[model samples]
Target: MTFKELKHFLGEINVKVDDLYAEKLFNECDTSHSKTLEGSEIEEFYKRLTYRNEIEVIYSKYASSKGKMSVEDLGNFLRMEQREDVGLNEAVALIQKYELDEAAKEKKLMSRDGFLMYLQSSDGLVLNPTHTLVYQDMSQPLNHYFISSSHNTYLMEDQLKGPSSTEAYVRALTKGCRCVELDCWDGPNGDPVIYHGYTLTSKILFKDVIRTVKEYAFKNSEYPVVLSLETHCSMDQQKVMAHHMKTILGSMLLTAPLGGKMPTHFPSPEQLKGKILVKGKKLQSREHSMTSPESLQGEEEESVSEEDEAADLPEEKGMPKKSKLKLARELSDLVVFCKSVHFPGFETARETQAFYEMSSFGESKAFKLAQESANRFVIHNTRQLSRTYPRGTRTDSSNYNPVDLWNAGCQIVALNFQTSDKSMDLNQGKFQQNGFSGYILKPRFMRDGQTQFNPTSIMQGEWLTPKKLHVMIISGQQLPKVNKNKNNSIVDPLVRIEISGVPRDVCSAETEHIEDNGFNPSWNKNFQFDICVPELALVRFVVEDHDTASRNDFVAQYTLPFMSLQNGYRHVPLLTKEGNPIASSSIFVHIMVVDQ
Candidate 1:
């Protein structure tokens, strides 16, 4: 094949080869001295280009002189390195399942290629397979779990000029997001619309969003979906909003108390499965009937929290004086469990707050609260739910670090899922714990109402075993080009390893850059980290181009919980900036964790 064909073939495999790697492969494959690859020569070039000698080292450790691993050898390797105590029968099954050579399978032996294939299979992945399902105790109170949530679920981009669509709801729900925010306002002709209240973002119809939410509510998770409504509508439109939800969601809507009365504790995700819950203000419990229009016609919502006031905009804060809006009787009746309420001081909350009532906090306020009264905040979360969202100043839809809030036991740390960063990466890694039901049970100390665990306490490593993590950056295979427009631009690739968790454990280290080898760049550098909190830690591996003239550009990244990492040779599948998996790009690494 010609050079152009070779480039196209690389594209097919999701490998972006620069002039340096391409030139070397072309020269090596031009055995006929024709300066181009023929039929068999093209195939030969591919085999040599993708082959990594690292696999041979691993295979040699367990294989015989004939480059084959017998059933006994495979079983021993699985039992010792992979930490699986499988018998010889299971080893033979794996050989028959992954080995392409029929003769090797009949002999109950795995070839070198088959060994590598088994290593790349799902069984060989770093994350435990049981974690990919709902494997946690789902019967606990809702406040006992960290829930996946999305803020500004309608905006696909910045709050100022982004387009709002029902597709955003679909995206968030499909990603196992249990709670979604909807900013509702009065639209033309007695209809309600959803968008950023005072921004240039285009509007999506409220009914369309409700329909979309109903369709995808249980698509990814069986847990409840909370519609956090920021209501700014007339009484008539409020009733219209209620009508739309009732008609579209039908019985899936949680319209009444689950068993005729609210529990002292919030309902569990298991109890609320296949249900859609509305989270909004309800009229004060009255001597008069609650369903009567007279009780609700002029009844105003509770004062707008600081986070929801008009001042809570990227460009506009402390500029508006509005506080309350009228609540319709029909709309007020829909709020069953998650009653939106103002948060007074912790003293007042612990003394008077109901289990069904919840509060929302801006990022700054939540972080400050967690800093000043972390133990109290954690104690509060044990009984009632609290949500933390990005501050108003984030005009670009950036995310704040969620680990601090999580450490304080905040249940719903809402983030812009569209803005992929270290924060969102940690969010994804955390939820992978409970089978992606969007609910991960908090640690026992964080769950106990009378707990003595102070997350902000200076006494580090007291309640848990401190661990030392040793990571060896082996190499990268077929990393994508940083600058796609420059076809011939050769990249100097490097790896940055990050540990994200509590304040004391958050740090990063990077490897030296390879001069110009996006393909098969080897580092063989090891990094050591002292982890203070192993349960909450997430390990992120980022690959980037080392650009001296300007800021380094991103190449790919893989993030997972530190506990999920396998200790032996493993391939970390690389993902794009938006957190989508790239086809064939990956980084190779070996991980070892031990008690410090």
Candidate 2:
């Protein structure tokens, strides 16, 4: 195309151009070229066209360089255009086209900004940002098990029904439960109402229960509740109930487990929407029925051929058969499926060995499998097994612990607790010390008069409290020398102690004067002295403004308990007013005297 035509096309595409250059070219062309131009005029017109074409090529290369340009970059270019009257809508459309091209290069159909941009571009697409799509795997094992007593009050006898179900839920919430289990059965009118039994007398409207709970949560923002719905009825009934819950509550529905004899609650993958979780039964290894004589003979013959092949190998190549068996056992268990697979604890002859052996499979393998399958691996371990395999140990020779399962590929650790008290503390000291976050306390031994194996109580006190001390002592070496600057010498040395303790009043600080004016300049003012005495123990006090030359020093004293052993111990606020101790900050001085 000619230079003028090309410039017009560029303007239509929202490409900015210099106004002065366009004006100069247009003026020259209008003056020289007639309707039918001669050879020299035509040649000049072609030269101008060539120059404009070169500029267009360079501009196009810069704009489409990476197959995509940021909206900010495009916006900046548009804003700097000589054409001040360009339409904003046209500019945005052009920018979006470029962004789409970039998204294509990244193999993503939509860029992170694409959704927001699209929403702003048009109001037709009703995109709900709050609602998230969650897929359910029917074949996967349940990582978490929830039990709800919502219908227990109605089902049980009048004598048995003591506290209301709502009160029980509040108690559970206070004890720090992330998941609550509820059983739902088919009520009259095909509506799935929540109940623990098959009878109608036990049933309570699931909609009513959910509405009440949701209202409670709205009033209390801190409370986070995830419902684990157990479908006691048929798959079709469960599906109908799920639909009703979704219609009523919308996105507040957390996760529901599809349960039945031959379970099939979620119809298609699409219908299995929302945070739907499937609980698979734990599979146990069972003994195979004995084969006929002929079948046994065939198996023996195949084994013999394998042994013959092994015998032909060189001595160096052939390792011990036992070692080979061990290696095979380890590798076989490490086999991970790309799709969801119900993983019960290893139940082979090498079950114990497999538990320890499988630990070698690093986090990368575990994470890769989890991502590839798009399913979380639920690891089931009893309290006994967890205690055996304590966390942080390598699989080679380390014992099994609940934390170890977590450290391994297991995304969820399921532990069975049998205790009246809900507070469960695993007492993994190192975990508490290192601050590695994990789920509920596994099982542990509780001692009344003697140690006993029981379902450990979840109601336990804080395991550990971090003690932080920041004692700002005046540098003995920084003391003013006789020959050094004397104007900045220490005067009226003041020390302030700040201590944080549990219960706030557990620890107090009291300062005592060990020896007033004990240090002499003649003995070298820079020399460090042991100012701390037994009476001053546990008190972190800072010394300031010591006037060594005048032999006049003020020692502010405070004493605190040697140790504070309470849950949630922290740095307590030190009561200080203008660098001096207040009466509230004072603790009685108890000088422990010892004969020298």
Give me the candidate number with maximum TM-score: 1
* lDDT per residue (tens digit) for residues 1-596 in model 2: 34566455334322224667755555576554443334665566545643323223323443543533344434443344211233555446655453355644254233323422432231111111111111112222222111111112112222112222444344333333333444555678876676433222345676666555555433322323434333444445655655655666665543322231122211222233233222211111100101122432322111001111122223444344421111111111111111112223334312432221112122333334333421122222221111111121221112222322332224222221111111122212111211111122211111111222111111222212223332322111111112123332222223334332112212323233222211210111111112111111233333333444664333233223223111110111122212222331211111111122
Q: Cα RMSD (Å) per model?
A: 3.4, 30.4
Q: Candidate 1 local accuracy as lDDT?
A: 0.83
Best by lDDT: 1
Question: Which residue segments of model 2 deviate by more than 4 Å?
Answer: 1-167, 198-202, 216-225, 254-344, 347-596
Candidate 2: Cα lDDT at 230: 38
How high is the CA lDDT of each candidate model? 0.83, 0.29
Model 1 regions more than 4 Å off: 2-35, 286-311, 314-320, 458-462
